[model samples]
Structure formats: structure tokens, C-alpha cells
Target chain A: MVANHELQRAEEWSGLRGFTNLLYKENRAWWGTRRWWINALLWTGMLGGLAAMVVFMLPTIAQATDDPAVAKAGGPIPFGLEMGRTVFFELGAMALAIGVIILCQDLIVDEKQTGLTEWLLAKPVTRRAYVLAKLVASALAVMILLVALPSLACYLLLSARVGSFFPFLPFLGGVGIMIVHTLFYLTLTLMLGTLFNSRPPILGIALGVLLGGNLLAGFLKPLLSVTPLLLGKVASLTAGSQPLPPELLLYPVIASVLWSVIFIVVAVVRFEKTEF
Target chain B: MNQTHDHVIRTDGLSKSFGDVQVLKSVNLAVPAHSIFGFLGPNGAGKTTLMKILLGLVRPTGGSGTIFGRDVVRESVAIRERIGYLPQQPRFVEYMTARENLTFAANFFFSGPQPKIRERCEEMLELVGLRDKADRPIKNFSGGEKQRLGIALAQVNYPDLLILDEPASALDPLGRQEVLEVMERLRKHTTVFYSTHILDDVQRVSDRVAILNRGRLLTSGPIEQILNGRDGVVYTLIVKEAPQGFSERLAGLSWVTHVSAPETAGASVWQIGVSDEAAAETALLRFVLEDQNVTVTEFSRKKYELEEIFMELVKGESDGRQS
Candidate 1:
């Protein structure tokens, strides 16, 4: 019996035993259904396909229209750079923020409300492992299908419109910025889901923070230093004629990462203290 | 940590309350290892709350508990690692099939090869008789099927202690019998600690039982001892053609506390309450045989059913509170 107990303990302590199973379950829920592919195609069309249309039509409108202001406004900036800027900063970031909130707002809330959290936590898995697995799995899915793939497709369409001189390094930095921004919302939504049992409160608070923070940062300049809105400037810094210095991006990146960590820590603590 | 410890679960002064509502009040329990211990209670009696406390799914407001000599609050993860729990309403991911659910549960404890995990899943499926419907989504399952799968998932790890909260509370008679059979088969491998309001099921399978009501433990002991009446002993006698004053004469004796003939038109069955079984056996039988006109047909000790004992204890406690 002692030997058997020791053997069981050894087996339980193995690499990612509980976390991997949870991850697999999460991935199966997302990828094993048709919802993932449909969402991916919908996002690609909305973000990438729209950027392509704008890029392809801008030159024609510049030549076809008699208005010199329209031609000049569309002329000075390279078409590829404008497309990258519009897709990365505006459409891509906004869609990802909203998409992540929609995807993650119910991740913990549904489980808790349906009594699945109690069932899962009754197993040998730790609370931290369970929360982390959901966060990690959802983050990976959103990053790959929602953010990275669409951003790449937008860049390719932009390149096809103009010459192949796409500013690759700066564009990569912008995508990284968008990713960090999306992580803020994802982690925040997950944290709120952990803190509350209902979906409306989590959704309202997370989305309110996303949209309200942007509007608040515009009026209050000091808020820009700490809020995730600084990530919005990544496209302007990368593509526009007057680009901000590269060092200016460090503060917001660090701040976003710090917020993500804080949200995750708070979530783990709240989840650990929760009773069923 | 002590393997030689006899009790698989031990709790002392285990109390819990949600704000002003006290659910469990100083519940001390010691469930012996390898025994099918029944936790009997009415609705809202804190049976599920106590099970959650033992499983460490809920914290105790005031008290401590230990499973296998491990602190419930501090070493709960270690405690849970060896125990299997089925909640009152067992909920699974409805999208997953029975096999997928069991495999997912097994992965938490066993970190072996894929084949080994699959083998374990197959074993649990067969154990619960879900092998035929292993691939069907659990959302399509019946209530009994879901409960059977819940049992299989609970025991997937081959735990030393299985805590099931009302394992057969929502099943039909046949379904309840199948679940009880599975639990009976599991007795050789693990100790089964289950809670239910069904006294008949407890009487049939459980070796020991604890009765809880209104957040307090009214009584707890072995089945035989509890059924034998904790206060005193009583023998039942079936006599025919008794004289008019026989029962009155027996009741007048010092050893015979009370006598009642339960049936009027039948074999004149009389339940004789006794203060001492040895004295009653030595004298009562001789006295009964000495009567010339009386024909004694059946005579034996009367055992109370669990339902009767539970009702008596609960009502006694209620009357005590009222007084």
C-alpha cells in the first residue's frame, strides 16, 4: 500500500498532467467545433478583406475623382503603409478587443453558474492550474485565429497593392503591440469572470474599460501613460511620416504586461478563495 | 500519513455557516475505513455541505478535519488526490462523450502512456456499464446514465475513498439497484461514503450510518446497534389463545417495562420491552411456557428499521427542542 501511494504521488507530479488535460479540453471545445473556423473566416473577411478593398480602391479613386484634395490626400502616403496602418491600429485592434471580451467573458462564469467549476475543481487539479489553462488556451486561440492570421493577411494584401517594400520589422512590432493590447482585455475579462458569477457584469465592466479607457485617455493625457491606449499608436509610429521614437513604446508595453500579470494574480487569488 | 489508521475520514467540531444561516454545527464524524458509511439526513440537513467540507471543496467556519491523518484545510490537495467525489447533481461537460469525460478525469491522476489512459477509460466505462454508449455525447444521456457515468468518473483514479452525495437519490428502482450494485462491487477496492435520504438503501448496503438533522448529528453507530435500540432491548412474541390477564401480568413484572400487542386479529403478536435481555431470556420464556392455555408460536428480538430509528431520533430531538 505504501508503495502504491508513492507511485500514485509520483505519477501525479509529472509534467503538466492536470494542466494539459484541461488545456486539451479547452482546445477541443474551441477547435473541435465549427465555431472556430466560422469565427476565423468572419474575422479575416472583416479585418483583412476590408483592408484589401480599401487599398485596392484608393488609387482608383485618386485618379478617377476630379478633386485635387482627394488625390493629394491619397497620394503622399504609400498605399501599403496606409493599409497596414488602418488594418493594424483601427480595425484589427478594435475587433480583437471586442472579440476577446466576447470569447472570454463566459469562460469562468458559465462554468461557475453551471456547476462545472465545482465538478472540475473537485478533481486533483489545483485552482491555479485550472485558471491558467483556460487563460492560456483561450489566449492562444485568439492570438492565432483572430489576431495573427488576419494581420498577416492584411499585410499580404497591402503588399499586393503596392510594391513588396513592406516595412517588415516595424509591422512586426505593430502586431506585437496589438497582441499585448488584446492580452490586456483577455486577462481583464478572465479576471472579472473569476470575480463574478454572471456574464453581464463581466461583459459590461470589461467592455466599458476598453471603450471608456480610450475615450478617457483622449481627454486626460496623463491616463495615456498607464492605459493600454498607448498601444494604439503602434501603427502611426510604424507607418506614418512623422514616427515616434522606438523607446516611446517601452512604457506602455511594460504597463500592459504589468496589468495582465495583476489581473491574472487577482483572478487566481479570488478563484482559490471561492467555495464551489 | 499513518497507513495503519483505521478511520479513512475524521472530522471534529466541523461547523459552517453562510452569513446568518448556520448549515453545519460542530459535526464530529469518524468513518471507518473499508466501510460503506451512510450519511442520512433530510433536505437542508447539511449533508452535502459536510461532504463538501470533507472533500475540501468548501471551508469550515470553525473546526478541523483530517483524512488519512492529513489536515483537510492545509493538505486538501493531497487529500483530494486520493479521494473520489460525486456531487449531489453531477455535472459534466455536456459536449463530451462518456469516454471523453472519464479519460479527462483519469488524466488528472495518472500520467502514463496514451494506451494506459485509454485502457483506464475503457475499464471505467465497462465498470459503469457505459461501454455501449461511450461515444455518445452526455447531453443525450438519460438521468440514470449520467449518474452512472458520474460514478465511473469519480472512481476513475481508483481512489482509496469515494465520497458520493446522494448517489442514487434521483434514480428509478432498477437504476438505483444498478448503482448500488456498482457501489457494492467497489467495496473491495475503496471505502464508500455516501449521503442520502433513502433509508432503505442505507439499510440494505451500509454497515454504519450517521443521522444528521438541522445541522446537528442526532445519532451515529453500526447498523445492528442502532436498529437494536440504543436505549434498551425489546423482544417480540406471537402467542395464541392467551388468557385475559397475561399481558397485564407480564407488564407488571420488574424486568418487563412495557408490553403491547401490535395486531388485534392476527396471531396476537406482543412486543415485550425488557430492561435486561439475560434475565428476560431466563425467566420470560419459562413464564410464557408455564401458561397452560397459551400457545406460543413465534418469539424473537424485534429490530427497528432504519426509517423508524431515523424518525424516532429526529422526532425525539424535535420534541426535546420544543420542550
Candidate 2:
């Protein structure tokens, strides 16, 4: 027998029995290894690098060429901080959503395909704990690396030129909306992981939701309020402090949060019914 | 449903199917605690499927199973808390070291001082002789090495019931010997439920045995009882000089059911089947000595080999199905 004092008896039988340990393992896969730094470089380079190029390169090119059109192309808003907000919120929203889908696409499907899920479920772990751990860990990684870090670096870069800090509350609101929008795809991809055995369906359906929703939203205006399609518009409007009606913003925010919770609930329920 | 306190695992009418194809028929098994129960079967006999059901990796379609009297489906986490399973093809995170894999599995049941967990991991590493390679990544380990690590990981929790699916299938003879030795040491502490095709190992380590064929259990009992000759009592005798009428006389006896004498190297090897073992024991040797020309060299009850019995059982089941 194993020594009594060396290991606890594990008396807890809740659905979240092994949640903390599994979450620690998933977090270690991100934070304990070089995966965190690698992701840091990738997202920061993609989002922050794009912001840097736009902030410094556009005005320098405009000045060197003496082209009034190039200067005007920076948009009607005062150039530095406003342009940064527009780029970070508008393009960053779409890029980070795709990035989250690609990064977390394999989280469930790969473990299932490789028999790791079978191995884990044989332990004291419940199916809910397994899916929930993947969701929490991946969501935190996406939020930190994909949304918050890049936004912070972009804030500093855009603020360096303006000689005044951007409004903290609006920037925070934009970041919060970006997190919810990306998490919609994160939970959707994870839910797909429990529903399907392969990675393609998970990737295709999740990316299709982001890309397909954006494309078809023009034809179906209702998708804007029901899905995450109009999230970027709301985020950009919030970050730029442009005034808009509450209904235009409130619907998508509530819908995204509701959709994320629904996806998580479906993932846990479906995974419980799944056989090894 | 038997709910016996002595049995570590019990299944009644456990069945499973994949789509329209049935993989496991109704299997009722009782594995007594602290006994090495060898689950034997031909390929596709549903041994692994049954193990999976007990482990809660696969849900049963037809029946109910319990470990420590908890329902397998409803109380799987509770069942898993006291059991350690090594799957047929043991898999781990490829990037983690052997020690890390062990530590990770250990944490599933254990939460305490970090040093104690590390110490337990080290003990398992040494138990499987993987101490030298503890720090190497799993991807770099060979097949046999990985199997050894798999054993260590399975035992790190010191589970009350250790379920192994072909635990020694990937090992060399020497490694197989070491694994058997470890199982022997653990037999007094835990009930070992393992499945394998190697009948020699089963005969060596297992006290109880069950054989399955084509999704149905053919037979199960103690190893000695299963090897005690399922047919009837038979005794073998080597006669160096036996006249032609000598064999006829023994065959004509009332207690002797049948007799066969085959010539080999100028000697007659006789297999005498008897209905009354006491009658044969008291009279047969005296009767053989009555023939002055017959010199009896060897006389002993025939001991059946496990392979022979397994083949006879499986072949009989197959033939019964075909017929």
C-alpha cells in the first residue's frame, strides 16, 4: 500500500474532483514551459508589430514623400493614439479570434485522438473537469497573450507619441470586449472538441463562425445581435469613444456571454456522454 | 450486483457493442482481492473491452459492474480513486520526462508535500528500473522503456487494484521476468487483474484464471483447478516389455474406461483412463506386476498444460458455434 501520509485519500467526489490538479497541469503546459514566451512573441509581434508599423511608418512615409494624400490616409482622427485604437480594436479583434481558434483547436481533439483523454478519465477526473480545465487554461492564455499584453504594449507605443495617456476606462472596455469576443471562439472550439473526434470540424466550424458570420452578417443583419459578428464594431466604437445607442452595443455583448456559457454547458454535457 | 466484500471487482452480464457489432457479450466475473487474476482470451475476445468498462473508459451497454460496491457508471471517480490502470498502448505527454509523467499521474490521487510526491515518484522509477532515465523525455524512450515507465506510473499511487492490459506484451524475456517479479511482490498488497496471451506467465504468477473466446467467457477458476484435467482422471504408464494380450487384459477391466498403448523406442507408453481412481490406484499396479513379461517403468497422473487446456476450451467453443 502507498504510505498514508505521503498522499491524501482524495475523499472529495464532486464533479470537479480533479479540476484543480488538471487545471494546474494545463496551466503548466502554458506557463511552466516556453509555450508562454513563444505565444507572447507570436501575438505581440502580430498585433503589436502591426500597431508599431502603422504608428511610425505611415507618418514617416507621409513626411518623406510630402504627399498630402498619404497623411490624409491616416484617417480623420488625430493620428497617433486614435489610429492605434482603431487598428488594435478593429483588426486585432478579427486576428485574435482566428489566433485563438488555431491555438486551441487541438486542445481536446488531439488529447482524444492520442488516448490522453482516456488516460486522464481513468483517474479520479470527471469529464466535466477535463473540458472545464481546457476551457479555463486556454481562455486565460488567449486573454493574457492575445488580448491584454498586446493591448498594453500598443497603448504604450501609441501614448509615446501623443504626449498624453489614452483614457484608461475606454481602453479597458475595448480590451474586455475583445476578450469576450475571442473567448466565444475559444469556447466554441472547445465545445467542438467534445462534439467531434477530428480537428478539421472543430477548426472549420469555429473559423467558419468567425469568418462566415462576418461575411454573412451583411445579408443577415440579425446575426450581428445574435452572434459575435458586431463585436469588433462595438469594441472599436468603445475604444474610440464614439457615441452610439446602447442597444447597438448591448445585444452582442449579452449574446456573446450567453453563447459562451451555452457552449461550455454543451461541451461538459456532450463530453460526459462521450465514450473514451 | 453480487456485491461481495471479498471481490475487488465484480461484473454481472456486462456487455458492450460498437454500432451493430458486439464486442463483449454478457460477462460475469468476480475478482477476489489480493489474488492475481489472469484474464485470458484469444484476439477479439473482449478482454480489453471488459477492462475498459471496469476502468470507466468505456460504458457498458447491457449490464452493471461495481468496484468496492460503487456503481461503475455513477461512481466511476470513486472507483478510479482506488485503482491504477495501464492501458494496452500506454500513452503520455511526449514532452514530459519520465519522472514528470509519474508525478503527474501521482497527483491525480495524491496531494501533499511536494518532496514526498517527488520521493514516491523516485521510488516508482527505481521499482521499474527507470531511475537512470528518469529525466529523459518520453519521446526519446524506446518501446520497452516506455512500457517500464508505464508500469511505474501505474503503481505510483500504490493502488488497491492494479489493472494491466498486456502489461508484459512489450517487454523482452528479462524485462518480462522483472515485471512478473514486481507483480509477485505487489500481489500481497493489491489485487492484480491483468490480461495476456502468454499462458506461461499466467501459469507462473496467477492464482486464478478466466478464459474468454469470441466475446463470451468460456471458463474461469483457480489455476490449479483449471489445470487439474477438466475431462477426468488419467494415468500414464511406460511398459518396457508388455505382451500383446497384456494391453487387452487392462482394457477389459471394469473400472478402466479406456486404454491406449503406443510404441516408442521399443517401449509401450500406456494412457489408462479410469472411472474409479481408487480402484486403479489399489489394483492397477498390482495387476501390471502380475504380468512377468511387463516391466512398468513410469506411472503417474497426467498433468495438463495450460496451453493444452486453453486450446481445448477455445477450440471446443469454436466448434460448438460452427456446429
Candidate 3:
């Protein structure tokens, strides 16, 4: 005859064992699939690209920093400051173009293409939550890419160029500008990626918007030349030797913001309406 | 998310259409709690559409329903919170391990404790028989294995309602059997509402069935009830060859009601609707033994396949959709 106490203890032990077994099962999936390695490599390459670009630019920066002042007389800004500013502005513009385009490309496009779109959507999580998770994951991945590569290259280049890279505040400011431009581009690209399912079309549209905005700002600059107050419309772009008019600069920024918001809305709507 | 009502699912005057072609008509259906409910329809039938509407993934042109007692549209979140959906083709993050994928899914559903989430993932993996492969990346997984992984992910939150849309259709015979076995095991914890045109599967697992065609449910009830209907019983008699007036003689018998000559190659089959099982058996034996030319090939009760039953009910529904 078995004692009641012994029977109860045996039951409890089995229950605990059952739970332990369950935990082991959930952890098992990590070993069964090979797709995660590719994703890791993709992120690594993405960040590596930015770092490589910055490293490649080191010689041009060193040359520019070494050259004497180009102005004849009564210069408003120092020669070194002017050259640094030129490099910074060019870097900023290019970063904006690349970042927005890259960021706009969504993780969902592959999901949609691979027919996994229907499967994931059928799960318990809402579309809003799904979209939010992808955004957070992609954003974090991009942040790692942006900070690891560009900032590292800049820090190393400055250390090599100057004895101590003193006055790090201005350098930090330039990086901060890059960060904002990257965020704007990322947000813009994410929207475009979600709005369209194809990669080529999304890339095409993203590049078109980036270049078209700058070109349109240039063509419209003369229209506003009579009224310099419209300089705001061209604040973020450069045409020929002139920087964007502050008034006209607002147009591109607002346009980018609007596009980002609208594309996200489309993604959410499309996701909702889709059968999956 | 919502209070459990008498009916777990309710739809009234539901209809769906793609342009001029209507897939569903004014159909009404209700699934009871704690029972296996099967939705049976052919490939182009509106079963998937109906399930999507219930999930709020697809917008129906007309009609409405309450899933898990929550409005399928306005209260989709509440409904979704209590339901686990496994699609026909489940897609997971290819870069994440099965465990990592489950963890990612758990973040959205479980808000309690981190350890509990891990524990829940473990439980789900075990349920789907993927405990050994929990760390595997999805890209390396087989089609059947991925589907099992999909089910594990779906059960992360321990949902009360498990909605599977043709979860086994993609699998080969062994895979299909494996999936159905898992589904059988899952019934203890959740109410399984699955849609599939595979009659054998439905007949094996479902407590009740809803057969739909042309976007409208032709019949919805217990599988036995729908199958039994008002017909008595069909007796299928296969002879070595058809003798002249064989059909006429079977029809003339007092015990036989409705006689049908079904399509078959090697044998001449005569289906006779019998009034009483014992009497039909006696008479069938007597008639076959009395006839000298009769070489009995096969004789048994002709049970209706679910496909045949579904076709019989929804055969004319599409003609209405054509207009």
C-alpha cells in the first residue's frame, strides 16, 4: 500500500518535471533553423558599409585639413573651419540620401515575397504590434550600423589627423547632424518599404524622392531668388555653390515627414486589408 | 479578453464577394465551446475567407460575427488575445532560432514575468513535439517541421480558441498524420476550430462539421447528424458482372428503397437504400444465393464519404453566384 504523502510527492515531482520539459522545447527552435545566421551577416555588412565609406574618405579629409585658406581677404570663417564645414555638409547630405533609402527598405517586404506574410498575420499578435516589433528590431539594427561604423571611422580619422582631435564638441555636433539625417532617412525608407512589396521599385522610389527633392529645390530656388525669405524651403539641400534657402528647406523636411507618416499609414492599412 | 458566451463563434447573414462572383451567401454559423469544429470546403470555397474575417484579417463585404464572444471587427484585439491562429502557410522570422522566434512572439502576448514567458515557450515547444529542435533556425526546418513550429508559436499565450486554417494540407501522408495527432493531443487544453477539405481528417477529428460552398454554408451540425440525415442506410452490392435487369430486380425488392448505379471500373455496384438493417441483410443474402448467375464480389453498407456529402449539398450554390 502506498502512503498518501508519498503519492502526493510523486505527483508533484512529475508536474515539476513536465514544466522543465516544456522549457526545453521552446529553446529547441534556435538550433533547428539556419536563417538567423544570414540575418546576422546582413546587419554586419550593412554597418560595415558605412564604416568602410568613412575610412575611404580619410585621405580627402586629411588633404583638405592641411591646405591653407582659399579666400582672398576679409574672410568671415576660418579656412580650416570652411573646409571642415564643406566636408561635413557633403557627408550630411549623402548620409541623408543613403540612410533614408536603406531605412525605408522594410523587413516585411521579404516576408510578403516569401509567402510568410499570410502565416505571421494569422497569429495572435495584431498587425499594429507586428509592425511595431519589426520597426524596433530594424531600428536597433540600423543604430548599431550607424554608430559602430561612421562614429568609429570619424573618431579614428580625427585622432590621426590632429594630435589629440581637440575641440571634440564640433566633431560631435557633425555626428549629431548625421544621426538626425539618418533617422529621417530611416523613417522615410521604412515607410516606402512597407508601402510597396517589391525591392527594386522601393529602392527606385526612395532614390527618386531623395534626388528629386534636391533637384526640385534647385529649380525652385530661382523662383524664390527674388524673395530670399523662401530660403527656408531649401534648408537641407545644396544646389551649385548655394546652400538651401531656410524657407525652402522646410518644404523638403515637411515633405519627408509627410511621406514617412503616409507610408506607415499605408502599411498598416494594407496589412489590415490583406487576407493573411 | 471577453467573457465566454454560449456560442464561441456567431455569424449571421454573412456573405463575401470578389467583384461579380459571390463566394458566400447569407450564411449563418455558430461553434459551441470546448468542441472540435471542422469547416469543410473545396479549394476555392470560402472557408479561408470566413476564417480571415473572423480574425479581422480580411474585411467581409457584408455581415458580421462575434469570435470568442467579441465583435470580429471592432473588438478584434480582444478576440485575438484569446485566440491562437495557425495559417495554411506559417512564416516565421528566418534569422531567429525557433526559440528566438517564440521569444519574439511571446513579448507581444505575455506581459507578466520574463521567466514565465520562457517557461511558456518551453511548454509550447513540447506540445508541438519540437523540444529537441527548439534552438534550430527556421530556414533549416522541413515544411512539416516549420508547421509544427508555427503551432508552438501560436500557443505561446495559452489561448482558449485555436483557429487553424488548413494546417495539414501542405504535409505528405506521414506529415499529415503527425499533424493530426498533435491536434488531437492539443484538444485537452484548447477548443480546436480548423478548416480543411480533407474529409478523412474531418471525419477522424471533428466533433461537428460545417460544409460551405460558393461562400454560403450548405449544412452545419454534428458530423453524424449531417451524414445520417433522413436517409435510412445505403447497401452497396458489387457483383462480378452486371446481369440484365439487375438494377430492375434490386428496385423491385420490397426491402430496397432507393437504388443507385455508382461509377466503378471492375465491378457492377448497385446501391440499395435499406429500411431495416437486419431485414436487408436477410433479403440480400437470400436474393444473391437464389440467383445462380450471381457471383458476389463485394457487399457492405455504403457509408457516404464527406466529399460526396458536401458536393450533394452545395452543388447548386455556385449557379446562383454566377448571376
Candidate 4:
């Protein structure tokens, strides 16, 4: 009886043991290849180079014009805040969202189509572990290369032009918002990959939701309360004069986190039911 | 788990279907421990499907199976821990080298001292004859090399049961021989359950065999027992000399069910199928000796090739289905 109990215990816990190995494999795939490095360099260069160009040209354009609004826009505080806002909203958020989608689009679909999922699942790993490892590794890659690195570069370049007046909290908050926004699409793309075995449908559905959500949020003002479009508004809130409203800041963060969790749960459930 | 049971794998009334199409129909199998079991079937014969069910890759629609006394579906991870599988078309990450792939597979089972894992990988690479090309990516491997690497990866953990689906189906004759040799070596440590369309490979390596066709099990047992025919009563009698009514007289015997006489190089060889061994031993020789016109040259039971038995069983099943 004791042996039987021990066997049962061992059997129950065995599936959870190999998750780290799966994570390691995923990490090697992302970091060891040249693809991740190239993408990272391109994204950082583009975002940093664009911010520098704006910082150098804004003052020149304001001095040449007789417009008071243009001159005010070139002021140090406004220029720094506006530059930070542009980096987060235009470059960071959109590029990270698209980057997450591209990185994870084939995470589960290619494995299933090639029968690698079947091979790996035949080991001591659980379905949950397999899905979680992919999510964790891909999320880390997006965070380091697309979100964290580019944000740092953009902040430095902006500070050089606007004279170090950027507050740490608002800039950090902006970066957090971009991460949350990216997670929404990353998890959604993973869920879609689990649901479908082909590249076209996964890409089509994820890209459609992303571009369509942005388009629809423009027309539907109420969606700002819940959708990721609220994330785009973070730049303005951080750039404003007053302290950040708790509800205004809390709503989109909470909504993005909730949607990410839901997408992850749906992906795990769908992957569990998938037949090789 | 019962340690006394000799069977490593057992299934009762196992069936699987995808939508309206049934892929396996009430398959009952018992694979003995530490024996090489050959699963033989033609194309679209549900061989791979049955293998998948056992490994828990695919679920069965009806019935149950057990490996090492654990339910297949409920305790799949436990079952998987003790078994290694080589899929029909084995796929690995093409970007990773053979050594890296093996290391990745080994990591799932062994969390070890780094040196121990590296040593095991090197051993497996040498065993599969891929030691020189261990660092080369799998995309650079030939088909035979890839198949060999698949075998090494499957057996890396030294599993209790090694299930290989078509291990050498895509290999050349020399490559097939090498894969079979590896399997034969592994037989001492594990029960090898491999499915293949190659009968000669099965005959050369398998101690037990099972035949499946059209999603149904036709026959299964020891290789010798199956090759000896179900009834164990078949004899080949060779006679030389001139006798006009020799075959007619032999066919008239009550114990003979089938008699075919084909003249080979002026010698008539008659394959006599008998129903009773006692009758054949007591009266068969005397009956043939009674005919003074024909001189008996050779008299022995006919041995069957695996191909012959497989064809007979498959054709018999097809005929039964049509009728």
C-alpha cells in the first residue's frame, strides 16, 4: 500500500519536472540564432534614430516660424515629455505588438505541423508546461529586445536634446504600458497558433484583430475604457501637468493583464485538446 | 504495478476513430517483456495510429490499454517516462545539430551532472555511427543518417520499452541492416515494439509478430508459432518416377485437405496439407510407399517465409470480408 501511494505521488509530479528543459530549448532558439539579434538591432536603431531626428529638428523648425504654439512645443519640458510620449506610443507600443505577433506566430503551429509537438509530448512533459515554456521564453525575448532596450535608447537620445528633465516614474509607467500592450497580442497570437495548424490563418486572424482593433477603437469611443487602445493614451497622461488619475491608469493596465491571462488560459486549454 | 506479469504491454478491445472513419477496431495486444515484437501492416493499416494510442499521443474512442499495469490515457506521462518512441516520419528542429537534439531529448528525462549527460550523448552518437557528424545540423544529414539519429534519440534514456514506427522504412538495404543491428543490440535491455512494412527485417530481428490490416488485427503470436501455421500441420513430399495416378491417389486420402504437385526439373514435388498428424505419421509414408511405380525422394514439413504467412493471412481476411 505504501509503494502504491508513492507510485501515485511520483506519477502526479513527474509531468511538471521537464518544464525547465523546455524553457531552455526555447531560450536557445531565440538567443542562439541570428534572427533575434538582427531584429533587435533593427528595432533599436529605428526607434533611437527617429527620436534623435525629432529632437534635433523640433527646435530649428520652431525658431524659423513665428507661431507661438510651435515655439512652446520646442520648450524643454514639453519637448522631453512629448518625445517620451512619441517613443512609447508610436515606436515602442506598435513595434513591440507587431514583434510579439511575428515572434510567436509559429510557436505552436510549426511544431504541430512538423509532428515535433507529438514527439516532445511523448516525454515526461505536461501540455501546460509545454505551452508555458513557449510563452515565458517569447515574453522574455520581447521584453529585452523590443521593449526594454529600445525604450532605454530612446530615453537617452531624448534627454540629450531636452536636457535631463524627464521624470523616472512616468517614463517607467510608459514602458510598463507598452509591455502590457505587447502581451495582449503575444498571448493572443499564441492562442491562435494552438487553435490552428497553418501559418496563414494564425497570421490572418492575429493581424486582423490588431489592425482592426486599432481601427475600430478610433470610431468606438467606449472601447477606450477596456481595449488596448487605452494603452495608446498613456503617453498623453504621462505628459500632462497633473498627477496621474488612479482609475485612468488602473483601468487599461488591469484590462490588458486580464486579457493576457485569458488568452494564455485559452491557449493552454486548446493545446491540451489538440491531437498531435 | 505487478512485477510478476511477463507482458510489458497489453490492450483489450482498444478502438479509435476520427469522425466517421474508424482507424483501429477492437485491437487486443499483449507484448511480452524483453522481446522484439514486430507490428506488420500495409499502407493505411492503422499501425501508426495504434502506436500513437499506446503512447497517449492520440486517444482511443473505445476500450482501454495498460503499460506496466498503468492505464494508458490516465497515466500517460508515467507510461511515457518509461518508454521511448520513434515516429514514422521523425522530425527534429532542423537548425539544431544531431548532438544538440539528443541533448534536448535527454534533458527531459535526466537532470544530471553536465559531464554525465555529455558522455551519454557522445555514446549515443558513436552507437548510431554519427560521431564524426555530431556537430553538423540535421538539415545537412542524409536520410539514412537522420533515421539513425532518430533511433539514438529514442533510446537515449535507456527506456524500458522502445517503440519505433517504421524505423528503417525509408533507408537503403545497408542502412536498414545497420538500424536492425542497433535494435537487436537494444533488445537485451528493452522490449522493442517496432512497426514496419519490411518483412525480412522483422523475420531477422523479431521473436514475436502481430499482423494488422484494414484497422483490424489479423493474427499475432510468436514468430515460429505463426510461421508454423495456425494448425501446425503442413508437409512437403517430393517424389521422382513415373506414375500417372499418383497425385489422384494421394488426394483421395482422408487426412489430406490440399495437394499441389508441380514438376520441377523432372522431379514432382507435392505439398500435402494434412488435418491429423497421427494419421500422417502412421499411414502417410505407407500409403506413398505402397505405390511401387513412384520413388519417394524427400518427405518433410514445409517451412513458411514471413511474407508467405503475411500474404496468406491478409488474402484470407480480404476474401472473408468480400464474402
Q: In terms of lDDT, which candidate is strongest?
A: 2
Task: Sort all candidates by TM-score, best to worst.
Answer: 2, 1, 4, 3
Tell me the TM-score of each prediction against the true structure.
0.91, 0.92, 0.72, 0.90
Please list the residue runs of candidate 2 whose C-alpha ends up more than 4 Å from where it truly belongs after superposition: A11-13, A59-80, B1-3, B240-269, B272-294
> What is the TM-score, restricted to chain A, for candidate 1?
0.88
What candidate 1 gets wrong by more than 4 Å, as runs, is: A1-17, A65-80, A239-242, A245-248, B1-4, B238-270, B274-283, B291-298
Candidate 2: RMSD to truth: 3.1
Query: Candidate 3 residues A72-144, lDDT tens each?
Result: 3113222333333344345434654565465446566777777665655554446655565555555554554
Instruction: Name the lDDT value of residue B187 in candidate 1.
Output: 94
lDDT over C-alpha atoms for residue B150 of model 1: 93
Q: List, residue by residue over B171-200, the lDDT tens digit for candidate 1.
A: 999989999999999998899999999999
lDDT of 3 by residue, B1-323 (tens): 33347679889888778889887777799888888899998888888888888887777788888876678888775677678888878877666789988876665454435666677778778878888998976788998998888888777766788889898999998888888998888887778899998889999999899988767688898887676643657777888777778778878888788888865786778778877778887777678667788788788877777767877777656666577
| lDDT score, candidate 3, position A39 | 38
- Report residue B128 deviation for candidate 2 (angstroms): 1.0
Range of the 10 consecutive residues with the lowest summed lDDT in candidate 3 chain A = A1-10
For candidate 4, the per-residue lDDT at A21 reads: 82
Candidate 1 colliding pairs, count: 0
State the weakest 10-residue window (summed lDDT) of model 4 chain A.
A1-10
Compose the digit string of candidate 4's lDDT tens values, residues A168-209: 677777777778888899999999999987889888888887
lDDT at B150, model 3: 80
Report the lDDT of model 3 for residue B137: 67
Q: Is the docking of candidate 2 incorrect, acceptable, medium or high quality?
A: medium
Evaluate every candidate with DockQ and list the scores. Answer: 0.47, 0.61, 0.18, 0.42
lDDT of model 3 at residue A243?
A: 49
**True-structure lDDT of candidate 1:** 0.83
